[model samples]
Target: MYVTSNFTWHQLAQHVGGIQLQLEEKGFVKGDVLLAITPHSSFELILVYLACIEQGVICALVPELTTLDLDKRIQTSGAKAVFLCPNTSLTLDGALEIDFALEQGLETQNYSEQNLTSLIFTSGSTGEPKLSPTACITI
Candidate 1:
């Protein structure tokens, strides 16, 4: 579900719940990772996690983490794609901010268990950010 506010969690959940039931009726297995890049309070993050669980995919929550941190995590987990919010922006290697916009309608994609869900960078408590694998089951 797409959302622009933290208060939208309940509404998004209702929408996604319907979609999940529909998908189940179709006999399609849920994907393994619900990737999110929005702020922690955003409803999208919550819906993604719920959807992942309903579909049996792992939920990965990655936010405000540096690219270096992301790189380490991605390399370690082999995540297929990172789910990013359309209006959000992040700086890349050249200081350019990349923005991903969500489409206007419903969309679905297939994924495998081998796919990386999310890579979490360690907080440098050990002197460096370490990547950790995030999966649906881990949620």
Candidate 2:
């Protein structure tokens, strides 16, 4: 949860949690899809994933995707929103639902597993990737 160069884990979590609630306020509900196209290991990447989990949004972490490919992926995934990290250069010009890094926070919620928590993107070296949604049920 290294949000900033020096922020503590709790601090980063709090900030991301706020963003999650804000997204919820903006209509991110259970099983909605959110596209995150950052380096898979970056802090913003994980933060967004956690937030999506809190609000029941399915997060798709797809890296190295072309702009057109991303658009196709979003379409295929039925994503309700998109999150472009600070380091991401790809743009979704005509995307139906998209978001950049939020500088604000909102009310937060505890982690509750949703019906669909994440999506896996599959593509060969030659074409647009397809997304398959999956949910992990705790026993």
Candidate 3:
């Protein structure tokens, strides 16, 4: 499924034309992992989330998270892989990088009755942050 931010779909298809075709011909069922690293655009986060739904793979999105936070999220999400931007760096136990240019495409996934997706994190208000979980699902 080549899960990525909004502007990279075209460029990703261009680079991995063979792989993309293989996926499409096989009903786009080859994808089982996702990597999202859009620092400047929230659209990237949104796109990746939708891609996860289409591909039926678990997704983990962490925005400007600290090293400790990254470790915790990765652990909890059990993400098979991670994709980060050129400028973003994260040190974790198991993470890989895939290179693709920015491109555009139309989103075709629908989520009318899906459960709310969210991550639990510390609020960091006091010396020790309190853990809170929020859901963003649609009915």
Please name the candidate that would achieve the greatest lDDT relative to the true structure. 2
Better of 1 and 3 by lDDT: 1
Error of 2 at 39 (Å): 3.7
**Number of the candidate with higher TM-score, 1 or 3:** 1
Q: Please, what are the lDDT tens digits per residue for candidate 1 over residues 2-79? A: 545554555555555654554344443544343455555555455455555555554556675677766665554444
In terms of TM-score, the best-performing candidate is: 2
Model 1 superposed RMSD (Cα): 7.6
Ranking according to lDDT, highest score first: 2, 1, 3
Write the number of the candidate with greater lDDT, choosing between 1 and 2: 2
- lDDT for position 91 in model 1: 44
> TM-score-based ranking, best first?
2, 1, 3
lDDT of each: 0.49, 0.70, 0.44
Task: Show model 1 residue runs off by greater than 4 Å.
Answer: 1-14, 17-31, 91-124, 127-139
In candidate 2, the residue pairs with backbone N, CA or C atoms under 3 Å apart (3 or more residues apart, or in different chains) clash, namely: none
Q: After superposition, how far is residue 84 of candidate 2 from its true place, in Å?
A: 1.1
Ten consecutive residues with minimal summed lDDT in candidate 1? 96-105
What residue runs in model 3 are displaced by over 4 Å at the alpha carbon?
A: 1-38, 42-47, 87-94, 99-139
